[model samples]
Target: MKTLHFALPFVLIAVGCDMSPDYKQPELPVPSEWNTADDAERDSSHISAIGWKEFFTSPELQAVIDAALDNNRDLRIAVLNVEAARALYRIEKADQLLQIDAAANSSHQHLTEAEGAGPDGRTANHYQANLASTAFELDLFGRVHNESEAALETFFATEAARDAAQVTLIAETVNAYLQWLVDRETLDLLQRSLASREKSLELVTARQEIGLSSKLDLASAQAAVESVKVSRAIYSRFVEEDRNALALLIGKHDESLLPAEASLENTTILEDLPIALPSNVLLKRPDVREAEHQLKSANANIGAARAAFFPRITLTGSVGFASNDLGDLFTTEAAGAWSFIPQISIPIFDNGRNAANLDYSEVRKNIAVARYEKAIQNGFREVNNSLAARRLIREQLDAQRRLASAREEAYTLAHARYEAGLDSLLESLIAQDDMLAAQQAEIDALRQELSNTVTLYKVLGGGVLR
Candidate 1:
């Protein structure tokens, strides 16, 4: 027993040797600055520093986003995944520690006279109680330690994934809400246009009845009214569909949760993101962080694989007392038995299985590296795209608003001329059609601008803080 105790310290000292490789983060695969960032002003504050509640100023939108964070099914699944990964990590970490189990057992045997027993049959009973540790690895080559590290990294990756899911959910919910508002506004515009076109049709019919207008004029007026009706129908359906989509995201069907009336023009969102920020901000993004964590896990897996090439040492031990009489089980006079088993399994022959595992782990690490780089590149592209949209969409929206205004003026003039018998009703109808098209275009541009704002917030990792 004393010899075994003395040798255990030397065996434990061997655990200090680690075969895992050191890990270093890969270099960034993208440019240092954004292409569209030339005209952007520099700001010290990063977009990620701002929480979602601060970024989305609308109270209604804030409420809706909060509900989504709480009730979204995908987010729930993401949270659960994090928990499961944490549990797996715990299981791996436990492998590195000592685990002692208490066990008790009793045995009975009978020997007949015809067998190896004496003339008379004999019965025997045995009882035992012990504390034992079974097949505990010594981690001499860091296989178990590296495996624990890999599991820990995987847990962190899942946490980052949960954050990514949350960021995406917030962005989608906000965009859906904005789309619904835009659809409602468009529907209202179509309804008003239809009313005006219907009144014009009534006037054109009365004029034709009195022989003051031709059939062509009446037919043109009727066609204009029908066109507006068709647009109204389409937009009305769009509004309802948008509502359903928003409801699905919110995870509730209550009509009261949605606003009865809202306007895209009235909606407010934070638009000034720090466009001149450094590319390192991409690292703060949840998706990018998730990819990095996955890469770290793969790197750690390589360490475990490398460790597998070395010998593994396992120890099994037990200390117990055995006695024929049940009452003598704990007595000092009873026989005290103990066992120590130290097993060493050297990698002498495996048909290249360990080599294959090392190669596979290296390949997985390479794949993870590529994925991490791709994530950074994707984030860079999304930010640049949003920045370009932010600059160009504002200019385009300005032009659209101006065009709609001009069209409105042109329609008014054409209608006035027709009423004064200075122009044909065909000119008036054409101007009205152009005016409606321009108005719709302007509304669409506004919606795009708002949606882009929300998208910029998401791509920049704004909602993760919240």
Candidate 2:
């Protein structure tokens, strides 16, 4: 019993592996202050947890996003990347456990000189079967543990990347829809304006023939009508081409196009701007989260590299039944054969290779941390800029409305005077042009305002889609 007791220690050490490493979340700067506005309190409790449906709210826009998520090639590629990372993590997890293997062998030797030493000191036919490991590293120095952590972090990073892709997809879809709406409205206005100008040209021609105006006056009116028609043709082409672009972004492979529209219903043109707290908002951004997860993976690499300087202990072992005949391979009397080899290797020296690895890992981790911090700062910048834009655009829209109203009155007055013979052909034409410009500008300003609100939604980590 005493002898057995002494042998059990060796068996236990040989048969078991404990490779878990000490892990802790790395330290980095966190904001003690937040950017808050009266319009909102910083609600930081996983605002991103909401489904995209709740965030976007528009059935048309949501449909576009759903289609893109399903068909977008970039999103599919990110999913593939996550799969690859998961496979790597599985490999790392397997490293923490002992592995078993099996093998079989048979030999019949016709001695070259009729003389050879077998296991029993005689030339003979031999057969054997065994289950054994070729090599297994004992992770006593935490190398395997750190490697596993690195793999886990990489998996998490991929998850965050997927979320970031989702955010980008939603943003692009909304922007494309807004662009389509802007183009359509502009095109519609141009078409109507062209028709009105043509009627004016006809009137001027008739009046010149009746001696109510000179030929020069008629020519000027006709020229204005032609110029507007030319502009209409250009705008029509632009509208059609942009609609096609939106369809592509929504992952359309067929001729079918998206229900392109204005985001006006989807967002508010605020009489008062909505503002959010900026302090912890950056952390919720998928891009920032992705960057931080990458930093964690890099930090895990440092632990792995640091562990390389220590001794590596490995246990290579095999246990299997043996027999001289195939029929007896698993027979009760075919007693099992077994072996255990516990090995320890120290990197006494590596001509600076191991040390360099350690330095490189640490430096890389530092770089990753810096990158994560930079991403956070950039996120804050986007949020703040979006807020400022929303505020300024609201003011612009108001001013543009006033200008449009004034130009509208001027147009009516000019046309009246021309009909009453108080204004020249040139004056009426100029006033018509000014009115069109003001009206177009008003539409542009409203479009800009809606766009700013969407930007705010995105910069705020995008409603629940975060």
Candidate 3:
């Protein structure tokens, strides 16, 4: 009988089988080299260590970034999600080992015989007590291992997702702050230009009264001054709105309290940017790592789904004692128990549930692979676009500066010629317009260049999340 029992275990092992299909990842569509980085040297110092302080270089902006990271609602949510994933992974890992549970119970019962005879039917009282009960499943195969690994991958994915959120948050804050700076600078410029135009109009009108200028020229100069004032008014409102936007990005909306400062010209700089490659290794952006983790998690799920077609072997057991007398329940002489029930479940038919699951897993794995490839391609595209944008903006800035300088010189010459009766008032007006336009264009180019750098930081996956 003992030999038969030992052979039964081997027989059950043979009975368990699976028929689920295997999973394969889809082909990658991404290129080996990124379009932007023609030569991204893999050096140790190539990575960006430019933190919020170094990148922003403004005390106020750094403070705002710190506050946003501390108070942002989205960041709080991401942190909670990471905790949840960690808990789930821990649970899955713990489940791999045996789980034991204990229970205590006491019962009393009275029974009466339904028959009567020379010996009359009598009532009997019984008492029973049990201290604990334990049950566990023995994992002989790798089912638990696959499940644990899947859970761990999900944990990593969530963690990476949180980091991705942080990167986006920082980028948004920088963009908002820069926008506020530009608006402030533009407002100041408009105000100053309006004042200058008003003074020019007064001078031209006085010349007309003295019979040195025509009435038509005086009217044109006054009209131009009025238009500048109108523009200044419009820009004033926009400046307030931009300040409000900056407040919102920092998780606050009280514009008066935020105290936005710093002009764009003072804060923005266009120069030869350092190209760091080695530091990028450590800054493995959350999105790229997140995509990879998602793929791994999907791969693990495929293993679990394929396991569905296979039979499962489980060993169930229980040991306990029950007695008519509560006092004797703990005694070994009164022990009563049955245990060690090992069973094997073979999947004879499931109406295609297992097959469908296998197919779903395969499709999901394919999707994950595609998503991973797309992320890489998108990352490369972003890098290329940012670098190109920066290059173009720098060139534009150079051209605008030269144009502004020429226009300024022309405006000075035209003003002197008009005073000497050698040039018309229209010529001075046109020169001033050209100068203002060129100055505005230079501002635009510089702001765009800085914005491009921000995009570069994001595309290169800066800001490590550790």
The list of candidate 2 runs beyond 4 A from truth reads 1-36, 39-46, 111-124, 253-257, 260-276, 463-466
lDDT of 3: 0.70
lDDT of each: 0.88, 0.74, 0.70
How do the residues 1-466 of candidate 2 rate in per-residue lDDT, one tens digit apiece? 9999999887677334333324444443544443434345344454465565765666666666777777888888888998999999999989877788778888875544435554445445666788888568866556887799889989989988887777777777777777776777777888888888888989998999899998888989988988888878888888788767766776674333344343454543223223334544667777887887888788778778877887787778888877666687788867678898988888886899998988888788779878887887777777767666766887999999999899889988999999999989889899989988988888888778777766766666654342
Clashing pairs in 2: 34-279, 35-278, 35-279
For lDDT, the strongest prediction is 1
TM-score of each: 0.93, 0.87, 0.83
Question: Residue 141 in candidate 1 has what lDDT?
Answer: 80
Residue 414 CA displacement from its true place in model 2, Å: 1.3
In the range 324-430, model 1's lDDT, one tens digit per residue, is 88999999857998999999999989999999999999999999999999999999999889888888999999999999999999999999999999999999999
Predicted structure with the largest TM-score when compared to the true one? 1
Candidate 1 C-alpha error for residue 25, in Å = 0.9
Which of candidates 1 and 3 reaches a greater TM-score? 1
> lDDT score, residue 424, model 3?
92
